[model samples]
Target: MDISRRDFFKVAGSTVIGAAAYSIAGGFGSALAQAPVVGSTQITNGIQSVGSKAKVYFTKHIDAAHLIKLYDLINEGIYGKVAIKLHTGEKNGPNIIPRDMAKAFWQHVPNSSIVETNTLYKGDRYTTEGHKETLKVNGWTFCPVDIMDEYGNVMLPVRGGRHFKEMSLGKNIVNYDAMVVLTHFKGHAMGGYGGSMKNIAIGCADAKIGKKMVHGVPLDKELDEAWDVVYKQDMLMETMAESAKATIDYFGKHIVFLNVMRRMSVDCDCAGTSAAEPTIPDIGILASTDILAIDQASVDLVYASPHNKDLVERIESRHGLHQLAAMHDLKMGNDKYELISID
Candidate 1:
């Protein structure tokens, strides 16, 4: 069912369940326990104590150097085998982050691999073979690109979630010691805005089981028929948040976020060549250790732009802002943040 803008905002603002106190089972749980605690109000480097607001770093320059600069600012906890979680994009999709920029940034990060999963929808990335070809066509051959779900899937506990008790993800995700969520901030057909949360939520899920969980499609449903089924928009957003929380809890303080807001389209990168042309002018890149803070900053920047009418309409029409509210009620991160200019 669809929700009106007024009713959606009221629901978003209302109190919901707090973060769950669940832990991963087996050895993964041990690693999670050692990971740095987040969601606290304490100030740290790259984060300020401006009324307990998280710090979100911004820069007008959208190049490799600037991207690396932003990454270094928040890279303190990122160590060991780093997984650069990013939307490698559909084949020949326009408005994706430039390959040159991503290549340069990838080279700068030591011991890192670009990580992705098969798409739920049937497309160029639906199969492992097809996904590899798409990666090549998209110019992602500069480094190791791991399709995390080529083999199988794994389940991660969804702490304090009303929708999902556990979320499914790529089993290979356990290999990474830290994750750098590199997102192309743009519009999504379903999630409103494809920010850091969407990048990890759907991007990390395996094609078969994990995706069905997020999309609320039955396992027996045919892939082509998945879109025909109707699901509540807010419930989808909350499920996305829950899936994101599973990933966040898995990595703990070992994860960081970066959102490249250059092509502000109302369509997701998954839309490929069929996606609508981006109307909003290019904005800067944003980085934060807090998942909620970086995405919230990106949305704020979009709304503040005078050319944001089209994008805003796309977001509002889809009730996309619920993403931020769901994340807030889940205590993933602070909605209030200090936007620090690094340029």
Candidate 2:
């Protein structure tokens, strides 16, 4: 999806106008409204699954019922090309979504892209081949990377990057009609938690872009660095939220956020170790079309969990950052992101 700066303007212009029209005619703009709104009725009425007491599945409990419920909400066409943006862990990591798990997860949404994106660091994942090799050896198979296809057009100009100077994306994603983001909900070393927002920035960016965002700056002026730890902390919160906003600006309704809160770890999946036992066990599954609301509720769950409460608050305080606060300030979505809880 590398377009010339001139073409970038064109994409922006047409996208803005079309988005406006979509908002006016389809109420798509209502989602970005600052005011909190709740749907007393089911916006998911025609979408609810046939059977099941569970509206959202539980820990490692992703069963047929769960898939059916999720599928009912997203399957507009009998067989459509869907993209499941995943988090393939680091070389030393044991947390990459298991292929068996991923296969089972996408069974309901069959014919998916199993779309793996590039990382943003120089450590191990500098190239797509590296990413592909790591994933394949680790049991990722449903969808593989095309060596001939350069998804991240870092070589050219990215369309509309709020903070990013340019972003190279694959043509597949730019043309993707529908996407189901499967995120592993866990606390990041840099941020309080890596949820829907980080999934887009870190999960979607190419190695070059990803590393820049991660190592951009460290906070603390007194520490000799111009940016404070807290400042850098807030920067990521800002960057992640803004990147998420940009993604929505182009493809809002087409995206759905699904956060898996099992194995609630203190570090990001990139850490590449067997994740620690949950401080507060039993983090459940959450489903929401609203990116903002789902993150808010998931963070609350982690903070409320005993093992995580200390780390969560400590990190937020130490860094002067909170994902929800940053996302709220950006108006990513309203504070009233209603929770359709599943027992």
Best by TM-score: 1
* Per-model tally of clashing residue pairs: 0, 15
Q: How accurate locally, in lDDT, is each candidate? A: 0.81, 0.53
The lDDT of model 2 is 0.53
**For candidate 1, lDDT tens digit of each residue in 5-73?**
224433332212122212222211111221222343432334455566777888998898999998888
Question: Mind giving the per-residue lDDT tens digits that candidate 2 earns over 139-202?
Answer: 6666543321244322222223334433333334554445677788876776767787778655
Scored by lDDT, model 1 comes in at 0.81
Candidate 1's TM-score reads: 0.86
Which ten contiguous residues of candidate 2 have the minimum total lDDT? 15-24
Cα displacement (Å) at residue 76, model 2: 5.6
